[model samples]
Target chain A: MTLALTLDNASVLIFALTGALAASRAQLDVVGFIFFAALTAVGGGTLRDLLLDRDPVFWIADATPLAIATGAAVLVFFTAHLVESRLKWLIWLDAAALAIAVAAGVSVARSMEVGTGVVLVMGVATGTFGGLMRDVVANEVPLVLKQGELYVTAAVAGAGAALIASLLADGTIWTTVACIATTFGLRAGSLLFGWRLPVYKPRPPRA
Target chain B: MTLALTLDNASVLIFALTGALAASRAQLDVVGFIFFAALTAVGGGTLRDLLLDRDPVFWIADATPLAIATGAAVLVFFTAHLVESRLKWLIWLDAAALAIAVAAGVSVARSMEVGTGVVLVMGVATGTFGGLMRDVVANEVPLVLKQGELYVTAAVAGAGAALIASLLADGTIWTTVACIATTFGLRAGSLLFGWRLPVYKPRPPRA
Candidate 1:
């Protein structure tokens, strides 16, 4: 449980950094940075908790995550310009956050003993929805939905890896490691090596 | 309770229509229409429920709203082009939905006996977040955040009216009527006469 909580907090902080970077790119005020940071930090987990009917969402139950997100936002608001490539930083941080968050989501759902399909969905949602909300709110196309990008696909594969490991292995640790490794590996490959799935192309209408 | 349920369903249907209209304008597929319709129909209430920690969210407890939204989407998918001005129809339908939804939110929160401030927040959230999600997902600047628009202001004022009416009147019916009247009146004025609140403008940084 402690490990899960730590992972969750780490993901929140990392995602908040990405959100703040996006806000800086948009040239928003300090309050906007904090708002975006907190929203992106909690959005996915909130959605998951709501869907799972978990009581008093994580941030509401324990204010640490919110505080961390706020602190991250303030730090970024002052230092974002020092980063020469905010977009590159945002994408890499987002990838790392996605890996950790997917593991956390899988842990939560497996502990709850939900169906595998729901677990997979929750894991992917937890991994991607925060960034999706941040980008959408910032008026940029959601990174998860960008043509040929492997964001959601990587999340799904990672969650699937965790599920398989859970069935094959004896403990939660192995499952979590599997999830993070697969998620981060795929996302990193996509960023570093331009790995991508084929995008859909419209065909001519039937004659 | 029946009255509240009816109002909720009505708002869901109207909101779904507006969402479907948005999808049509975006030129998305039929599936996209259904997704947007259901999303807009339930987004606000879902957020309100999550915040209030309402068990078994409204749509989860009662699938009727989801069904109604899906039906609205299918109907609009076939007939949207028949409307000469989809934007005009979307805005008017959205305004009506906003009023009904605000009343429903106030009713739910009041029934829970929460504090007035939380009730008001729930009211505005339940009225506006659905359309906000719809616009965001469609990659359109959210109507609520449009420059000086009375959208959110109308919802807030309407919710505030309900609170005042609740203090003065003896029944929920009076509060509901006041909410709907104020919300619709302000929104209509905004559309018809360009009524708006002053927007914030940034000052130049000091030398």
Candidate 2:
């Protein structure tokens, strides 16, 4: 559990720091930055656990992630002069978070023996939902709804890969590797190609 | 269930329209306003039902609420000039929704036979959590977390009143009235008196 928690906690810090940078960009107060960091850290998993009947949620059960988030938020707020403009860093940081969170969500859901469909949805949720909530809270339109290759679409592919791998292989390690590779590959491809769903357009009205 | 659906559908529009008003006050676009309205409408009950293991979620079980919210959102955006400024009317409208939501929460929880403490918590969740989410999404500190004697406090008092009444008397019209009145009275009093909890100040640093 300690080893596993290390993976999850590392992901939490990465996500929280990104959130703190965003708050600094917005010029929010220290308290506001802490709020944003904490929200980014736990918002998605909390939503998933609440929906899936997982109680004593991760944040509630392990307070370390939250404490670390608070610390990071405070540090960033006080030391804004130390870092460069976060625009470039924020994008890649968000991308890394999306990757790790998708993997973590798949692992958690798989441990519970949730079905493949649920796992896929949960993975996307774990990856994207926190950032979505953060964007909304920060008063920005969600990028996924605008010019992005399917955000959740790639996550679904990744989880599906893991599910299929588990059936074909003998070990959890192979299954996890397959899923992560598939999702990351698909997401990168989509990003490179600007692949997107066809825009909905209504036929012109008859004259 | 049909009758309940009809009533709920009507209320969803009312709540969303009011929420749209609130969102517009923050200068959000139509999409943002619609998102805010949806959250304000279902966010509270979703938390309660998920906690209580209620299936299919009330809004998802019937698409009526979603449709109503979307339609109301569209109307508000196109014809915002036709209506009063949303901020001016937000308090009373939010109060009314809170009154209705708290009563609905207590009744539903009691029907499910949830224990008193959990039931009271659910009531507060149903009545006030959505507004808290709304504030966060609007980039404001949540009013509930402030020192204000506001919505959550009223919901707790009202839920307590409902529990006591339901235990002592038959499930009559009076029970509903008592619950509603208690919440309304408490909220109104808080508003009128500018009631608030004392701000927390850290004690002087120790030597």
What is model 2's interface RMSD? 9.5
After superposing candidate 1, which stretches have Cα over 4 Å from the reference? A197-207, B1-43, B50-128, B137-139, B143-207
Against the native complex, each candidate's DockQ, computed on alpha carbons, is 0.11, 0.07
What is the DockQ score of candidate 2, to 2 decimals? 0.07
Question: Candidate 2 clashing pairs?
Answer: none
The true-versus-predicted C-alpha distance at residue A81 of model 2, in Å, is 12
Query: Against the true structure, whose TM-score is highest?
Result: 1
Q: How well does candidate 2 score on lDDT at residue A206?
A: 37
Residues B88-134 of candidate 1 have per-residue lDDT tens digits of 99999999999999988988888875667667767887998899899
Task: State in Å the error of residue A70, model 2.
Answer: 17
Candidate 2 Cα outliers beyond 4 Å, as residue runs: A1-49, A52-84, A91-128, A132-207, B2-11, B145-150, B189-207
DockQ, 0 to 1 scale, candidate 1: 0.11
Give the clashing residue pairs of candidate 1, or none: none
Task: Name the 10 consecutive residues with the lowest summed lDDT in model 1 chain B.
Answer: B198-207
